[model samples]
Target: MDDEAVIPISALQHYLYCPRQCALIHIEQLWAESQHTAEGRLLHDKADKPKMERRKGVRTVTAMPLAQPQLGITGVADVVEFHTGEDGVEHPYPVEYKRGRPKAYQADEVQLCAQALCLEHMLSCQIPEGALYYGETRRRTVVPFDTALRALTCETISATRAMTVSGRTPSATYSAKLCYNCSLFDLCQPRLLHRGESVQHWLHAQLKGE
Candidate 1:
């Protein structure tokens, strides 16, 4: 597949977060940055730089471009460390940087898994795991690329690709937990749209009574 036609690996995370948000950004070409997003970008500044360094038998690369043509997905990994194993082979271990603490959802994990998949295809080796570095916690959370996670990553890829191809934005459903935290909340207006839908339903019910 052409690079232009490939879906972004980050879309998997966004889709898992909210399908509407995913469509709004990827399909509708809309974006609004909140404090959270700004902070995240700032945190990524260091990792976004393209650099390579070797320290203590490990070679670390920052801002590595990753793509899996078969899966039609592409993205940049924040950091990928190559560790020399006992077999005298270098194993790629991707580490993703996030602004906040670990979420209750698997969005971050799925994103990392997608990166691992891309690296596995590009390097022709099995990636056993990766890591997520949370800025808030200043810690790394290890993520195992188990069967279930791989399955979920593939499923998310298919769903995100389908949504992107259809070019349809899902209707907004307001949830204080999700919507308010989203960077595009003002642009999405999920609460207002949900209210409109409620009013429309009420009007339809009145018309049915009449």
Candidate 2:
């Protein structure tokens, strides 16, 4: 795929969180912001600026553009710290910034792993791990790019790309835990749509009976 056709790395995270959410944003071009999203944007203010600095022996680049055309993925890493090794190789360690603490899902990890994959392809070096820094916790959670995570990232990429190509938005399935806090919850109206489906089905059955 060409550069223009590459999928955004963020889409993989959204897909893992909820495929319907991914479809709503990527496929249907819908968006709604909540306090959570606003906070996230504010937290990214520093990382969103492209800059480079060196601390100790580590070279830190913020808002680094990353792309792996082979994987058809592209995105900007919040921070990529390059640590030089004895072999004169600069090992890349990506750090993604988030607004909230760790969640029950692997979406955040998958997003970090996807960044590692892009770096690996671009730098031609193996990345063993990366990290997620949460604003609320003010700490970093290291994530290993193990086989399972790598597989899941690849699967998410494929699924997201396929959904984009198909141009089909998935139906909403309401889950209080997942949907309540979603920035797109009002726009998605999962509960209303799910209820509408039930009513439609009931009406269809009644008509058939008559």
Candidate 3:
């Protein structure tokens, strides 16, 4: 919660999905791997290792470290492709790996844009776009670093930083689809927590009543 604390770039995506989930992981340091997370881990295994390759005027770098101090974000990009133009200029394009199909939200894109922001800072060039590679479809979806998405990504970063400073894990709000898919569902106990208690608290109360 220090004023100078650097938020993990991953927290941006997490916060976009669910602020409570973000706080639970980053602020509370709680983690549990569910099937979904396990699959994601596997998918990222190749990208997690740093490597580089060159082909046909394009250079690819995997597991590239990225950080933007102005935005207070630091993380690694899954892959970054540098394309050479006829003008002999090279453009850096980031590619993010996802374990599942694209979500109905902007979480994935924002994360990719954050990587581009880092590239811009490090390379001193404008990164106009990036891509998201989904595991399920095995296809790359191009994402433009448009004004709207850029603004939203910045807002999410500020909001997430504030949440971290507050040092409060938000109370659970249950959604059948979201909560059911969360890896921390058991630890979160969204339904019970929403009722103003947790499973342990309810169990203790029941024992006392006996």
Query: What tens-digit string does per-residue lDDT give for candidate 2 at 1-210?
Result: 854457899999899889888988887777888999999999999999999998778999999999888899999999999998888778999999999899988999989999999999998989999999999999999999999999999999999998888776777888998899899886777876653243334346669999
- Against the true structure, candidate 2 has what lDDT? 0.88
Please write out the lDDT profile of model 3 over residues 40-117, one tens digit for every residue.
999999999999999999999999999888888889999999999999998999999998899999999999999999
lDDT of 1 by residue, 1-210 (tens): 865457999899999999988988898787888899999999999999999999888999999999899999999999999999889789999999998899999999999999999999999999999999999999999999999999999999999998988866788888999988898886777866653232334346669999
Best by lDDT: 1
| Candidate 3, poorest ten consecutive residues by summed lDDT | 194-203
Q: Which of the two candidates, 1 or 3, achieves a greater lDDT against the reference?
A: 1
Show model 1 residue runs off by greater than 4 Å.
Answer: 2-5, 194-210
Give the CA lDDT, 0 to 100, for residue 155 in model 1: 95
Give the candidate order by descending TM-score. 3, 1, 2
Off by over 4 Å in 2: 2-5, 194-210
Every model's TM-score: 0.90, 0.89, 0.91
